[model samples]
Target: MVPGPVSNDRLGASNGRSSPKPRILVPEKVSPDGLALLASDFDVDSRPGGLSPQELIDLIPSYHGLIVRSETKVTAAVLAAGTSLRVVARAGVGVDNIDVEAATAQGIIVVNSPAGNIVAAAEHTVALLLATARNIGRADRTFKDGKWERGKLVGVEVGRKTLGIIGLGKVGMKVARMAVGLGMKVLAVDPYASADVARQASVELVPGLADLLPVVDFLTIHTPLLASTLDLLGEAEFQRMKKTARVLNVARGGVYNEAALLKALDEGWIAGAGLDVFTKEPPEEGSVAAQLARHEKVVSTPHLGASTVEAQENVSLDVCSQVLLILRGGLPTAAVNAPLILPEEYRKLQPFVKLIEKMGGLYTQHYVGARGGMVGGRKFELVYQGELAGINNTRPLFAALVKGLVSSISDSGGRDVNIVNAALIAREKGIVINEVHTRENSGSTYASLVTLRSYDTDPAAAGKEERGAEQIIEGYVSGKTVYISKLDRFTASFTPEGTLLILHNYDEPGKIGGVGMVLGRRGVNIEWMQVASLEKGDQGDKGLELSKVDSAVAGMEAHGSNTKGRGNEALMILGVGGVVGKEVLQDLTGEEGILDVSLIRL
Candidate 1:
């Protein structure tokens, strides 16, 4: 029975903040009992059914948690619109309906109830296996029409049959166990499963599909629809299987190549198939799936692998509890994309964590243009030096850097991107991270320092220097305080905070006054300013892996030969009181010798 909603306060955060309850949006129908659990402590809006794509996008902007079923398509657009969304929960095992890559990119945790519907789906697969092998659907149709066709409705015996299971996961394992109990010999092809585990289940492990396909009397695919599993069983595979072998697919759509399966059915490559899913749901009119469903030798169900009432109830409750945990700043039992970090480790890494993100933001806003960014597919290479290099894990710091990079470019909440999912999000955006650690410090004022270098995907032409990689932001964390000491070719000293206006220009007269004039007219105050290149030389630049000479040469080539050296150019780091608008920025840029102007908030 479904439980009723209860009143409660907000969840207690790991950071010790008693923030208001997280709002959960169930765009698709889930069990009321599961919703009741969410309602007890958090706010839940269980919509009657799935909404249109646009409807979900429009409604997701303010939601922190989104619970969905198979019906809801959590596309990239919908995830982007969810500015405050922290987690997305699927009430079933497969999250193919959710844009997991997009969700991860925005640092949103994606969780699913892997165990809830396992038994039901496993049972359904067996049912379809029996039904198709015996032509039960055709017999039922003929019998319902008041026709007797006893001689034509011949069936095969399940006992002593050879069954090949493609995946040995929860549902697949359950199906294998059931098949073994029926006196069937089972062969599995899962690299993750060991020989001991398969032996425990009374199943034999095959080296590959080639070894299993030719021998089995029945082939059942239970793998998820991933890049590797997409079109896993096709024409070639079908031809290799036994002529009388039947097929079963209760896993996901597109797992078996639809066109190949249809051709196999028509050409008698295999006896028949039992399909519960299609590449396109509802099997559109005149579509391949539609034709496959109507085949005489095939048994079809409307993707009812988990349609039982018990399955629905179990999934809903399981998914809700997972959502509840994430909303309360806790990790779920089955998170698809979330960083696993101990609380002690997180605390130990906290100081550097905050510093790294600021460095990412600073690098983007301050040095990207100056370095003539030649990014290699939005790549960032981090070189951790000195004491910090000895730490076991550096994922949290890297994730923080990604969070900073993303937030610097958009109005999206920085909090939306965190250590939990930032790395996954970065990958979806084609962002690459290469990290190097050096326990020995070559020579530096600070005992520990981190350098974040950014570059795009495409490599530069022959003999051309990748300027983006040459440009880096160097920073350090002292206790809990973070400070940026270097930017590109400039020796900058500032605490990353508020909004900063970076001005690049030749070391000509009136450059500072020109910026002051624009700000003065616009009523934006210049609280403080630090001018680099005016100093004689940088002792800190010595012994660093990245030399400053290359940048000097690049800058000279970019400018004219008339500029002598460091004194010829200057980078002014200005602490601004207010945001400089487009007009004001243009005004500043129009000033003589003002090479570039960028405003970034940190």
Candidate 2:
């Protein structure tokens, strides 16, 4: 049975002090033991049966921390209200419920218990695969119905079947190992992964989706939801699968096209399906997910992959420990979307970090310019300060930074991009990568500054540069905007979509309006625009300062409330044009305008 709510009055109690037990509130179901432990050290409060958005909005302001599961929506509103909230813990692996951007912007650390659910999700996948193959659930129902039709239920043998796995991540790898032990031949396809690694897992790696689609008797999907994977298994791809093949998805919703899948099931495009997730949850009573559950050929469950006793206990313990640590003024190990800088150090550089990261996002988008292929790969570097050694999971942030940089260029196509293969890919494409790490205890207990560089060859252009790779793009996230610190060198920025119009021209009158007018005339809608400039030798524009650009940009106090029409141009990102192979820099700068345009990648 599900748990009940905790007393809200007890939750409201706080020791009269400027610094109380950094109150952590668990609004989702957590293990009793974990809660007891937290109550001993923290002014803990917890409840079950997920919080409605408004209730969460109302309660958020009262706590220093919050915890939840997939059912809760950690929207921007919750983040805005929780001014006192220092940390948020998701008692499960996936953080799809949390608005990571909102949390990060507000300096709230978001943690997830990923390791806790791995074993359970993997084991559940195996159980479903076996159940689907043998029709165990169907056989039991039939037998209870007084129909002994053993002859009609002749099950397929797994010993000789080729099990095709779409993703080779933690769950996929576990499935492959178990399938192989059961005498099934395993073939996997993962473009971003190494074939050598798959072979090491004792599975054969096939080329792309086209090759694996028609040959397998069973297919399983395990991947994240991003631009590329959105609606991945659509109508055209469904037609490629053999009619006898069965498919399974236990990873994320929308990874499969539900409409296409239903048609496939009805049209016999595929034999059957085994699903643990859907585009929507517990699905409406007569929805496709529910309808599919009623079909004899399909096997279903209400996302039971992480429902095991062990997984729940693990998640509860993991989140409990994380909340405790953060309340004690230490950063969490499983924070889902917190930026690389430490909390204390981050406070110091908060203003600049936002500017730098935003700039880096835009700068990256400018050079790579909406192109899909790998640009002359760029090198990544990070300088670490005190206590980084304790945080073993910092690697994901590094990859996220690279992905953020790449996303600025090719929003949809650059997602699979990661730090593991980023340098290698850069090297293969003749891009150089350099890394630097520094440990110091002077500034803050824990702090870091990152720098990303790229060769001169533009990601939007087909041409190569004379310099091996010009330092075309760079930026980092640190502290508050007005008082940001010089955490890194060079101001790099990138946008997430379409050609960017980067203007570094003289910051004179009418530059922003001129640029906007030029782009508008060229049929480009200004999606989002940020302008930054330094008053000669001011606090901003200092050499080697990530915060300098943001200080300069945010410092320009608008003349009045009506400040939309004009400003000096420091940088501009446009969602101009759709997906294309070429850059459109010439159009914005060529027209009679004050801004000099540099067409960067989407």
Candidate 3:
């Protein structure tokens, strides 16, 4: 019998005691190779033409999985209608058409093949660059119109020319390699990538656009479109480039300002431009993009960067594998949101995952300070203790930790860090990671504990007096809630959520109230507060009064103190609401007896 849409009722009744086979619906055309692979184990229904939004909503509730290409929009209405949908698989990268937030909120996994089009995009970038530089498009049009004006087709050679790349990601790195093979000097600017990574790619790493624009003969952008990158090349940036420089953008639309680019082209700020993507696809007739496409100095394509047969096949197969794995009760490597942890393990370890992520975020934010640049050559160590150490799959937790750590340092264009690319990005930034699992509790009060530590490779680089100072944070799961148990030597407990203010101050009575006053003045509400004194030991209030005396501070001097030999130190962890500005932080730090204050949002 020809497979038709299977309803949830039919599926549930198929096996009285056993689970039914997952039914997958493919509304858009995919490679036969991918379809055949899914057909082997699933009830596959393949339809080449996509369905309308209403049609999709009507048919979606029957199936367990839905796969599509760019043509189909996974709207929130459709997601809400998919009563049985476990996954929404996109055949290619850039899930602009998918409402990923809605899918994630509905507990439906969204997977995309990010690596499938890297080479295709890179080749297209180089192709467009060479075409623009050599006036290939104009020459072809003139020749087809029966004209032989060789003099008017004078062009520049790419050999030995400097190419500045905006982002050194997968596609950008491939472009760099291809440019180098053509004997071009490559310079790149990526905030997340280290100098070591740039050297490995044989490219010079510039700190930002200002440093990269003036020196290069060609500029290419490969960054995703977001608030930070939208209209990245504006009038000011275009003016910074050499008048003869060329521009290429094959990564995303809206990254280059259409108005600014047209102005640059018309004003002769740049010689030419090659574009494979635009702010609006199929730009309106008589629009700026349409006019630019017809310009003699511009060569444009209809978003054909991933049009190769190999790229389509690769993405189709890649997303198909992920869908099958997720349906079969396995974790997908390229999941765009949180991991699909096993039900039992997820119930037990979900809070722990959140706790560790917050801890990692808190440590990185505190270590890097407000300037927000990565410390060079650092190492991240994760230690899992007690019953948490024996979990069969710890990859998800590691990815969560790395995600939090990297997200704190880099601008990810609003994209989430996931298991597939977290470790890869960490390696790109020259971070060495080590993981340890032990059955012992490690002298912790809780049953399970996770500790994260970050340190610099060079001892002197970490600090002057405190050489090799490591930022350590430990947490544990208790029942349904997660608490940060210890930070450095101070012991306290607070739920790892929302915004937090950690203060190191003199062990005096008025310090806590002083902090409260500053936050209150700033209109920030304190939800919870925990204070631990290093000099007071773990004896609670009695130890506090005892350590208040000056000579008694000497007895507890073994515990580390920020102000050594002067007095005992107190640590306050405050859960706060609303924004805590630098001015408020400065006020808190300026308060008497307040030594240091660090704020983090998780």
Candidate 4:
């Protein structure tokens, strides 16, 4: 059937057609309610099933817009088929499978229903948790198998269990509230969330994982799988968890280490695990996920958390609304990956990105050493992923995140900066700036992750290869201290305020005990400690090379204000029986094994 043509001006200014209603194609099944609304004003077609990628490639060129669910793979090839397409709408949050870059480059707006299924997803996580804890699915299977042995299917109750939620945003907070309603004690671990917010949700909020591990009975993970969060729950972390504790992971796979988890479950280090995601998809029979599914103690599901009928309808409605808005030239509101500052602000921020890239260059020049030549010339590559993808001024936002990160490293002691001058200055110093953007909604904030990479030299200097070297630096803006997230090779470490301890030790047994003993004697407390070996992952680089520790130690030094009196103060205190003096603090902060001290004030 030939769809009706659009009006003259509505055909798009470039096409120069007369008054026309935009033609839309729902290539996949959408909410009937949403379709009813779209049909009122749009030339709507709902052919949503059994279409091959080739069929979609053949059909999309005729429509002005396309809407779809997970059944479609909107790859670059598929996008190329949409010659007249003005918008692509995803009826759900994640756009990972879509070729967003291709659409954006074609000036086609992409829209998603980010808010519609949030509560649904959150509730699903809770359901999965309860099911996992109480052996609900196992019990159902047993009953279906002609078994009436209820006594053998004993399970735990949600009531009175301490639930640890990793991310305290919408999904995490909703789960927290629901868990509270079920009489579970909810504890949240989110650095971004204020304590008052958790309290308002009737949950206790802890600042870090160290504080959360020993207390919870059931641990439910909701944090996104970012560089910092990948393998977040690993062998070391699982080892710290209480032996009686059970784990539930309904968020993204890879956020937890599947191998480590297998070890944990197999060794009985943990009571059991409930997983809806795995590092691998559609795992083979007898795979760890499959084995877990067969295990009486463990519970597993096929990623059904976001598959409810209500969730489907809500997401369709939400996506349809956003599609209409985008077709009318409006930006998306539920964009999950990047936050778009106003155009005026974006224009104001572009130059700063160049400035920041240059500052990254500066850090590379000094700490990155000879191999740091990758950032020496040409433009630095900055990837802007997330909410930034939905905006018309996405490039500018990319520039802003980069510039914001870079300006943070300079000793300029100034605030206002312009892109015009930033580029000029960067160019004068032979700096190049390039960027790429992508996005998704991971039940966290519509966030932006900007990864800065050097332009030339060896490619290995980009991610994990560049670890030990200090990739980021701290600079004073006003009087407050700010944290800059940097990647030293594969590891991401942050410097938070407190105290600094510097320790140098050989790779030997009892080093940790020795360090602890020294600190204990001087009355200095150790809140948390982490040790990284540069050669641990690179077995080829061990013993002879000290690795990134020297650079990491130096980077920590750059963040602290220089202390004045050390030895002299210690002597003075010792002269008067020496309570609370250098011996104690030095023993606490600067003992032989103490690499650094970061005192926690609160």
Candidate 5:
């Protein structure tokens, strides 16, 4: 498989001064890491402050990618002018500022870094929840003003309290877990979350907001600002809460109506409110949002939910990674508007989409084409394990995998691949699809795992399953990152992102140096490398899987069937940054003790 047009057109064209690379427009301040990544492969125009709608419309036509934060508004008019745009990405989770409907109609992908900032947002929610219960913010302000009215400022206890939550997403689940640890009994209302998911978090699921409101001592919200959720909490909802109850919001603005919240405070419907977001940021002096923030009973902060350094870095990398993947003819899982899937299911499967597609891309590039086209396999094997295997419809996952396969093999940028047609394309090409579902075990190392291997038959007979490559790659998602847990028999911590160079060599001195010398001469920088050799099998890298010397001895005694278990074999998986031509790989293979090399891009 060859690098698709995204690399050859956007990336390879970028290698010289004659042809311009894909251009990305950044309208607001984003992480420097993201900026650097975009700048390396594309022409970047960064303004940080923002662009007016007219300025954006005027400038969007020539750009291929656009990266924004919450401030930049991607209007329909602006999108209409973005004739060349391939993607519009938000550096954080929300895409409210981006005209998603317009982007979808134009066949442009809309993506956001949803996984990156959940922890930061969840922690901030807890901070506000506690600050409101204990009157910590008002206490700090009054104490700073030289008043110490401890009796009047006395607060309530949260332990053993009944906590109510709206929206059981990643952030909500985390908040629920934290509340449970603090001895709170949690009840939640979310249409998307399964009862099993909530039960695992030790939360009791309720039917709706109505069912949840009346019994809460503290109510917290963590939902998006959509039509249904807009003004989700109003006077009527507030009236149902306990007179001493408190509420907090750190998710998005306007989910709790501003005027209604003020009335709740004024009427003493609820004890206090904690807010980290406003319908309008920096609300005018006399506006409802401003009044809510200034009220003596309200504990407010500027929208700082995703403000930590770690969150900034994570979001930057996550968004940039998707943009790069899409530009390079790959399907990105973090898309807000993908074709032919229900909105809710897309949301649930986004991260796993990235994981499965990457597995397919990796398998096709290194195993399929490298081993020769259409081997003995009757179909590609996909195995699902853990809680996610219960998904009723997995066609989207299959389509995503096939799209990755074509993206790795074709040069058309995979622009035609969509959830509806990827499976159809595979059938037309004589490639069969197979799947197996299994449950997660507590004794297993990973909570969820997706395995990709080749399933084969004699072709003449066609009834029985046989091993094709027998090389399996199992992918795992932890927190916000996707990694390869097991690549064949070796346990691994290999994050299959960007460009990777996998080298198989003999366990001998200078083998590593030989490959390094070739790459160095070619100006290809090795950003990271994972090594596995028989001599130091006890430990190699911090998280990478390594082959052992003892295993090699056992393998040799067992007649040397396993190549990795041979007494003098080693592996080097390198994360390379910068362009490497076929010449570099040819030169690498010519080096002594180097048996093979595979360069996989996703």
Candidate 6:
């Protein structure tokens, strides 16, 4: 039997409510404990079987809050029908079925139990890993069929084996702890997590998947399914793994290529696989996932990572607590949208937020174009200069900067990259963050400035010059407009917006015309341009000509004679209308005096 709603008076005068209790609608079955807690302070209407879309739409208008699990699809239509709904809470980590944008559009807060089922999912991952390693599923099935296949059930031991974890998030970290307890060596690769965080967990931090793949006896993925991580473990990755290695995916379905896994298993590229989720839930009868489930070397389960009773109760309670907090006019801890920043402060920081985000995006893309990839190491430093340094609250701006920096190089999948989870995602990837606050003007021309730099920690490159070893980008707010003031050593004042193409070239004649010809031939229009040249001292060109000349060349002794015509490096920053294609890029690079080129889209 469903529990009856409680009166608002039961919550006492501290709740500041003399009116009727807030009405909460539970369209899907939740833990009884969660319902009882809601019933203690609010009116709850629960339907265990869950209401159909039309039924939910018809009943949602009367509720002040709605709580649901994965089964209920909170579509835009339902959100549109929810005239009085103030909050929509999901009892699980993934809100795949919830239209969060729709809820936000209606000014309804959407909350999720991000950490409630973490342990359950972690335990489930370990269970699947063990099951796959020991051939427990096959053994149990054959024994139940009355066949004694003892000799065929030989298994590998997980102890002392290397386990490579793709993401060290809440569930992933728990799995790391459990694996360590089981005597396994853990190697984690997360671009957002710092080395200190990994050291605290006793896991070796690897920078890339290639570094982790060949060494691990077991490869388990915990990263979200984004454009970068979709089909993360495909043919190439499977080929890199040891033939005796096992693969596990308890995070998401699309993380591993199902067809590739089937082929890997059939071709003996991997020993076994344990999958709790699939790209398509309840995979087609004859699909690769279904075939893999029937394979002797594979162990598969329905999506049950958070299926435990304890996990269900925890998520239900967590989300319910958030719903109650919001209804009581308190801020929620796990809100997945813009933070509850005060209006006055928000207005002050709004322009800076956009400025820093664009700066970060431009810097990362510029670095990748120059170095052929993302920044080498995980450590990054953020400096707030001039008037901006005096602001006590800069967390939101920092988060925006990180979101912009990481989102450009990685795939966020369906998850929204906002201030709330940006730092969380950054930490999961082992990205070290150092923030500096200073009130000194530092001779800045603007009232405020934000600078981001990625520290290169390569031992081999430590002895070399600093020019190509690090990345630094700076921006500032002028009045209401935001402009990028500097990039590396070249100084420029240009609005960091739209599509931009940056070129590093010799400070010689005809270079600009050559680049312009290439862009013109490709039908690309230049909206704006900024040029800056490296000073003689800045380029270390003071004694370069003298050192290069022999004593026999007496007339060449003067530095002016050797370098008067050219040699100083210059930068051309072009704001273009459309994408600068590879062909145009190649032509630009091949032009005389051109050294490097990078394109950034903001």
Q: After superposing candidate 2 on the true structure, give the runs of residues whose Cα lies further than 4 Å from its correct spot.
A: 1-20, 48-62, 71-83, 96-102, 342-602
On residues 1-602, what C-alpha lDDT tens digit does candidate 2 reach at each position?
Answer: 00112233223333233435556767777777667768877777777866778888887776877878777888999887876777788888777688776776776667787668878877877777877888877898999999998998877887889999987766788889989998999998764344445677789877677888889989988877654467778778888988878888888778888878888888889877888998788788888777777778778888898998888889989888878877775655555643444434444444433443443454444444322223333434444444442444454445444445544323123333332444443343333444444465444422443434444335455554434444433333333322122212223333333454455544444444555555555555555454444323222332222222222333333311222333433443334453322123455455443444455543
Question: lDDT tens digits, residues 1-602, model 3?
Answer: 01123345433332222334677889999998777778878888888877988999988777788899989999999988886787889898877788887877777778888889999999999999999988999999999999998999999999999999998878899999999999999999875555666788799987778899999999999877743467888899999999999999998878888899999999999999999887777988988888777788899999999999999999999999988887786666666664523444566667776777777677666655532445435677899999989987886687677766655544332134655566775675577678899999967778889988776556445545332557678888878888776777776677767787888777654565566667777888877666665634643432221222222324333333323333667677777777777678889889987778887776
Q: Please give the CA lDDT of all the candidate structures.
A: 0.74, 0.60, 0.76, 0.56, 0.74, 0.75
- Name the best candidate (by TM-score): 6
TM-score of each: 0.55, 0.62, 0.72, 0.60, 0.54, 0.76
Best-to-worst ranking by TM-score = 6, 3, 2, 4, 1, 5
Model 5 lDDT at residue 139 = 94
**Candidate 5: segments with Cα more than 4 A from true spot:** 1-20, 36-40, 45-62, 75-83, 209-211, 341-602
Tens digit per residue, CA lDDT, model 5, 1-602: 11111223222332233435788899888888877877778888888888888899888777788999888889888877776778888898777688777777777777788779888988998899899989999899999999997998889889999989987767888999999998999999764454555787799987677788989999998876743367889899999988999999998789998999999999999999999999998888899999999999999999988899989988988889889988886777666665534456756787787788788778776765444334212467788888778987888788777767656533223433567557656654455678778886435577788888765555456655545546678888887788876665555678889888887776554555566677878988877767654333643332333232222222222222233433466567788888866678889889888877788887
What is the alpha-carbon RMSD of candidate 4 to the true structure? 17.0
Among these predicted structures, which one has the highest lDDT?
3
After superposition, candidate 1 runs with Cα above 4 Å error: 1-20, 49-63, 73-84, 94-106, 340-389, 392-602
Judged by whole-model lDDT over C-alpha atoms, candidate 2 comes out at 0.60
lDDT of 4: 0.56
| Reference-based lDDT, residue 186, model 5 | 99
**Over 4 Å off, model 3:** 1-21, 194-197, 285-295, 338-340, 359-372, 375-377, 383-393, 406-430, 436-451, 458-602
**Whole-model lDDT, model 1:** 0.74
Root-mean-square deviation per candidate: 16.6, 12.0, 8.4, 17.0, 24.4, 9.4
